[model samples]
Target: MNIARPLIQLVSWAILVSSVFLVKALANDSTQNLSIAVGWSKPPYVIALNDTGYEVELARQVFKRMGYSITPVYVPYGRTLSMLKSAKVDAALTLSENTATQTIHLTDSYIQYQNVAISLQSSNFKIKRPNDLAKHSVASFQTATKILGKAYADAIKQVPLYVELPDQRRQVGMLLNGSISVLVMDVNIFNHLHSALEPIESRQLVSIHNIFPPSHYHVGFLNSELKEQFNRALNDFQASQAYEILVKKYHIFQEALSTH
Candidate 1:
């Protein structure tokens, strides 16, 4: 009698194990099949919230529909590239065209924009030309100048006093502190943080008249094999209506669209 009872219990456990396996298989089948890494939120682009921010979220959804498991990594702009170089990450969310040419393989242009140097109104310094900066101190990130050029970078490096800030937001703070006479960064990044740092109305910041050409940003790939797969997926994503939805959802061309 006791042997029969033990046998029945073993049979019941086997059935439960089989059911669990079936459920796992079904779940796996339902999910897409790719692995990706998207960099942290820089805003209006790569957002790093618990919920994917606008553009990054769009990228996530686009890849998910195509079969991808996105791993979002929060990193400094410079570190983002380091990760890519080390193969620790697949691609950076959004980087300038210049960066693409200089660093990673870029996809077709998804977005483009002009970036400029900005300085607080209280400051007497004015930038008429790149050379005008010679007299004053500048706070800039090392990664930023790469987009500008080795010449610009060399010039910055040559300045009598140049403060290197790892974070763009910190550079803004440095501007306010009078530690540096000027701050150089993406215009959009400055605009996004300006309000939080100080009243936009109270402060007078100027964007130099000579524009930095509208630089394109796109999905990047480090490994060529992965790049090809992503390129195909990216093209497929572009052809789908989902792509348009993403552009609108993230307000990708906000600076241009806002005028309308």
Candidate 2:
């Protein structure tokens, strides 16, 4: 027997055993660092720049309670799905049970967004529900087609000019200038960032249509066991006084904010 061949065989066996143990160790590690995928600069939810926003911090606290830490990966809303599917990241924020990402496990509804259809008051558009949007041009956040349900999806297809983009601030300008017939967004999101994002050229009154129901979003995970752990932690976090402080910190009320 060649001495080098036997030694190499021994080393390979050790490596294989080590890998198995490592996998088991990580599976049981409570202080694990998770790579979480989240979307771009939507204030009060995801302020991607400094890497700290309402949902971001909320996730941090929830994970912290479980002795886990999060490393947020900022991608566009649409990319979050792909990232999760490809296992490029560990989890995705703001996904719902309705999101069509196959093999992805979802947590309980941790956050709710009051999404609305907004148009200029001058247009006199009577958009009471999603189907009413079929006749007009619309701009909305990325993945709105998937998350807002089938009725909204069908309406978007009928619209002559419908656009969904990651930069929601630009869509606000489009709605104000009459370039787009409607802008679909969360009520708190528009309220928190409109003054800074709106164009100086257009100063127009807006009509908010509560066409869509409140969207309850969950965090997504590729690992099923991790999902169970997260849900347990989330339940504990929600019941704690810390959770109340977090909601108030972000100025997010349990009741929908007045859509004026």
Candidate 3:
């Protein structure tokens, strides 16, 4: 090859290598960034499909207070812990010690879900407690089995027909059409979907059973330092006016901390 041509080729290759390194350095700046695994479709808590929801906004605001930005890694509710354990994500939203194994550092309780059993009023389901679900067909939000406590877990095992769905919208529809006898969902989610998918006059069709105790949630972080930072930021943010506004923006109520 001509000397001049070879020299130009060498310079071009070096420049390309330098650019690649630069891009990676910027992209992998873990020190100033965090990737959190969030549920893909629990609207209100997480609508990770579009990345706008209560949990998403909460994480963004809390992490921003900690001098870092956040990127939500949308996954099924079941994958949040695994993703965090595998180092694929810096943290996982909407998880707690009960919903996890001994793998990561869990932040303080930052959110709560008032999980309840809902059914058609016509069904007359005598579901006054978790065990009552055993006699009926039930569809609940995915990960409910693990997060809803031991009593709920043991009760679901006795269910004649039980299923877990990632999005409650379908389960809500199932409950509405009498396909399923009961739906275990967050109250806010039930109300939100009910409003959107049915007529106001049809609101009386379902009965919401406030049987399950509220599920408190925390963020699982890969490292203790991050956990500490996040918890501190979470506490500070939850005490600020901005957090009040955020709660109002999402219309969170007493039982619907994870609003829809």
Candidate 4:
């Protein structure tokens, strides 16, 4: 046997080992990059990509602990659902149980949203129950009817003037300017929007009635494995001080709104 034959065999083995390692490293890198869709721009939840709100930060931290990186893709509320169904994104954030379909696997609820019926204090609207909304000119965010449940949808349908707007800021302006008798939205969102108004306007114009119960939100994923992974990561994050720090950073607190 030629002595060079053994050396060539050794070189081939080395090349094969290196190729395998390279492939594995690339696969691991791909798995670590998670693409997620974020629908709403509500502050303290999702302010922007740079100033990512509390909820966004929470998700980021959870994924970070799981050895994954998050790429947040902003879209409208309705488009977020479509993207998940089409598998355009690995996951969608801030989805409710009512909004997720059977094809989508949802992670455990990580946050509770306090939704309220708000109007200008001057209007003196009374919304003790869903039925009370039937008599008012109402405006809400897109898909609010479905996410809020059938009772809300039915009651809103009876109103002579009911519209769903994509822009929460516009809804606030309409409520303040007498275009809508009442606006149904999360209390935090109202606070965020109200903060932008003039000092006197913020003080005297807006009022909120705690008519709706709190809604729990979750992340929706196309893959069940990813959903389970997120749930475990979320549980871990919740048990850590990092979660508390994020909440404080975003100023996510329940502040009593002045109601008539």
The candidate that achieves the highest TM-score relative to the unseen native structure: 4
Displacement of residue 88 (Cα, Å) in model 4 is 0.6
Question: Residue pairs in steric clash, candidate 1?
Answer: 41-46, 41-47
TM-score of model 4 vs. true structure = 0.86
Q: After superposition, how far is residue 153 of candidate 1 from its true place, in Å?
A: 2.2
Tell me which of candidates 1 and 4 scores higher on lDDT. Answer: 4
> How much lDDT does each candidate structure score?
0.63, 0.84, 0.81, 0.83
Steric clash count of candidate 1: 2
For model 3, what is the alpha-carbon lDDT of residue 8?
A: 92
Alpha-carbon deviation at 131 in model 1, angstroms:
3.4
Give candidate 3 regions above 4 Å deviation: 1-31, 99-102, 254-260
The candidate 1 region of ten consecutive residues with least summed lDDT is 251-260
- Quote each prediction's TM-score: 0.72, 0.81, 0.82, 0.86
Clashes of 3: 0
Window of ten residues with lowest summed lDDT in model 4: 197-206
lDDT of 4 by residue, 1-260 (tens): 78899999999999999999999999888658878988768776887748488888888899888789889988877788788888899889888887666788888998888888997777767778888899999999888888887889889889989988767888878887778888898888888877775475446566778778899999998888888888888899999998888887877886846864
Instruction: Flag clash pairs in model 2.
Output: none
- Candidate 3 per-residue lDDT, tens place, 68-96, comes to 88888888778888888889998898886
- Tens-digit lDDT track for model 2 on 93-186? 9887776445899988888998998877778888877999999999999888888989999989999999998988888878877799888999
lDDT of 3: 0.81
